[model samples]
Target: MKTAAIRALPASATVFPILFMISTVHLLNDSMQSTVTALFPVLRESQHLSYGQIGLIAFMMNITASFLQPLVGWFADKKPRPYILPIGVCFTLLGVVMLALAPSFAMILLSVTAIGVGSAVFHPESSRVAYLAAGSNRGLAQSIFQVGGNIGSSLGPVMTALIFIPLGQKGVLLFVIAAVAGIVLQTVVARWYAAVGAAPKPKKAVAHDEKSALKLSAGKVRMSVGILILLVFSKHVYLSSFTSFYSLYLIDDFGVGKQQAQWYLFAFLVASAAGTFIGGPLADRFGRRNIIWLSILGTAPFSIALPYADPFWSAVLCICAGFVLSSAFSIIVVYAQELLPGKIGLVSGLFFGLAFGLGGLGSALLGEIADHTSISTVMHICAYLPLLGIFTLLLPKDAELRGR
Candidate 1:
């Protein structure tokens, strides 16, 4: 019988090749997404747009992804479609082409929505792939997967400085190559996923995990999830301030040129990428709860000081804040997954969706604040957001999670 054959096949081991391939695709996917943010200054100048408009653009893209990712993940949990990987990249490809030629603000929104659709399909599915390929090293696997995204995100500032400033909105066309590469790489990954799917899942193990997950009362689980969501909201809203407005702040307050300002943002993002890479391994060695606690709370001092620092010190503070703050996200995702075992796709999708949604919402609100007040005020307000890390204390300890 097919079941007998599937059972006869050995259990899957850590699949590094698949993980790397998926990580590369994530880099490509996120780099393409980052192009939208990178285009902000060019668009603002060319269209004579306001801060609120800029925030709307970011919201359009990110909110679309936020709304759709959970659905994509839920569907995948029920019935995964391997070919969806390449299909998702096709959407991004179309978005890239449309973005390059978009003449009106409306067209830009439509184009970003397409890119958002692509991202929605890509993240949950690819995260599931990372989970499948992870075997026992889930933390390391997630870190590898997440570091690519942080690195890719860091490229936005670089692109703004190097490419978009010179090429204008048309520069977006260049990233079509990243989309094509993503498609090819995703195809390879899809095949491996398909092969993996042919193996029968360990239902008994899954049942055990499900039972273990339920050991906490429903109320306890709900409370835990609520706390995690709060943690995510706090982390992402703070990050949104940096991503959406930090460059403009530098330009307006510090007298830096727009292009020069991007370099500062780049430093912060690059530091974030480094932090993301280390956070997972550290969580694997230390407790996830400990790392999450340290990562989010530890950034408070630097973030609190950043608003008052001079240019040189501002950059240092931003870098420090970014490095420390970025470490918690991957660990948070991993912790959430452990909390609700067997719903990997759903949990990943929910957290990732919250991240994008909350960040987008924060950006939109903060942009309005910036338009009404000064960017400096925005920075000072966001500086205190990290203090919300105190809530992490409410989370159940790592040993409790493992024991359950």
Candidate 2:
């Protein structure tokens, strides 16, 4: 029941600026990726991407982020992670610059790959740092951290549109400005971080016996991790696929206009933003096991509910469903980190990585279903994966979920 504060993860003032820098960078990278979704016709027609290829490019960052995030997290535990934040920003900046200047498909893919890899590198370290800065109020702090990403996703379309306005002159200049700002921020932050004797680590509630508890085999942890991966996959499909396409789907299928259809996305994100705060406390009070199981199971009825509703009410269904899907996100990371208290970085990365990287692949497949089948069909099919996560988590919670 004891909840004591950990030593400051960064300089007291530094935490806010670091979070600010990281959040802003996230905004830019996300805004830039909307390039594929918003400019689909232009990019697809000119470059001749297959339906699969287009989705792949859209989620390249997810795939790479999935693959590399755990390794980055693992290393962060052993060595200095201060530099990883701005370094991730640098990757996005470079990648975006390449995208703006891309002359061929190969170059475009390469640039997109950089963006993916870069995002992966930043997540574990950033999440860990965010965890520390949060101190005793993990739930509240993490929700704010998550909201930054939500804000970024929302900005994606808006920023893309703004940049697209002055396509030739302003777009190019805006990108240059983004890259330079990132580089400068990285430089300043790294210098400040270098003065530490020990690297950053979150303050644990109690120093649980590290060696005895770590005896849980990697195999067992991986299985739990695997279940989490399934959970995240479903999550990605619901968010990446549904969130990205519902506006279009509502318009195309329901004979709604783009402006009216956007209302669905707005409502859905609002619900989801609420869900993040809701899920965290539920996990802290009840167990992550029960909450996740119920949340995933809830997806089935909600998914089925959405397509059947009359147009007017369908937006309501999608909004509620989006919230159900999003509710688990931050809760899942907190759960995973608690389980593998042994490998916070690795756990953090894997929590985000599969969600980003492998989940990136899943997102595209969802997109393909959209391209060929129907968006509703894709959503319905994707809903089942969360139900599968129940088995993965059945073994028992790997870590405690005590709130201070």
Candidate 3:
């Protein structure tokens, strides 16, 4: 009977509509999340916030997501919850509403925590959807899913320049529309997910999956996972510097206006989005290990040059850094998924959680450094983070990952 049920499952195929729809929701979800950082300038001026306080705001949001995501993924792995998709966005909606009206720092922290909780729920499950929907084209599907987030995140600078700077904190109210749209779209995606969940999977495929997962020794698997986590730390901490402080760096160092600083940040983020879109197919063509090594390590030259460049050159170097650095994350996620073939939700949640956890921790620590030292010092220090990418050479080769 079990085998019969398993045999009833449909063969995997690239489901573009579901992938695109979930990608769209990712855009909405991340754009809403980006509002937190986008409002930093406004919040700083309006509330006379210290750099530490600013960092704490990001810490509160990201830490909440980080702690919760793995647990959420664990639970979903045991018992799939299709409706959790739209239900999670409801938390974000509530958070956004609270953020717009939040009058104090404590209130803002609470609001962002709610948004974080929403993110914790959203990512693991959505990634599982992408995995399910991906036939042989997992790379393209994950890229499609991730590029939405990169583009959505890119909007932060644009929102800072156009909305947050002008409208102040109240500008966050605009994202309420985005949250609502996410809920509606997630609902549509949920139905498909439920249907797919009820279908059958082939027994031979299940055996193959089990075999692939056991290809590496337990110690080897543990070591590889540890290496992957360190890579995530390197990638995200460096990125947190840009997302949380790059604009401030420009405003302070080069005497650029706030809006102008945001435009510079915007160029970097847009390049990141383009890189995310490009990275996956390249990985599919080349190999995950090669791309991961090149993508993370490749940014070293550009990043090392950024802190010393003139304002124009700073923007150019940042663009280069963002493009090269951004490509690694989706590839990393896909690679990790390959490493642990059957535990999709748990792996997704763990890595995404690590990304958030590391970024938030880095932001908080860097903010302190900036307060005691200078933003330039912070930039100078963070420039060396990419060099840690040299460790990627330790990861198992793509052929080994295929059990070759």
Kindly report the root-mean-square deviation of model 2 from the true structure over all alpha carbons: 5.0
Candidate 1 C-alpha lDDT tens digits along 333-360 = 8899889887778888898898999988
Which candidate gets the maximum lDDT versus the true structure? Answer: 3
lDDT for 345 (candidate 3) = 83
Local lDDT at 135 for model 3: 79
Which candidate would rank higher by lDDT, 2 or 3? 3
lDDT of 1: 0.88
**Per-model CA lDDT versus the true structure:** 0.88, 0.63, 0.89
Off by over 4 Å in 1: 1-12, 197-200
> What TM-score would every model get versus the actual structure?
0.96, 0.79, 0.96
Instruction: Give candidates' CA RMSD values in order.
Output: 2.9, 5.0, 3.3
Q: By TM-score, is 2 or 3 better?
A: 3
Instruction: Write model 2 residue lDDT over 1-404, tens digit each, in one string.
Output: 11111223533322455445555554555555445454443455567765566677767757777778888988877885676677787787777788778888777778878877777876677677556555454544555667656655654444434444336312643665655666676555454445432344334523553543465667766777677777777777666765456666666678875545555666676677677657766766776777777777676677766766877787777777767767677777877766666566777787888767655676688778777887677656765555654564464553432221
- Looking at candidate 3, what is the lDDT of residue 15? 75
Please name the candidate that would achieve the greatest TM-score relative to the true structure: 3
Q: What is the lDDT of residue 307 in candidate 1?
A: 91
Full ranking by lDDT: 3, 1, 2
State the weakest 10-residue window (summed lDDT) of model 2: 1-10
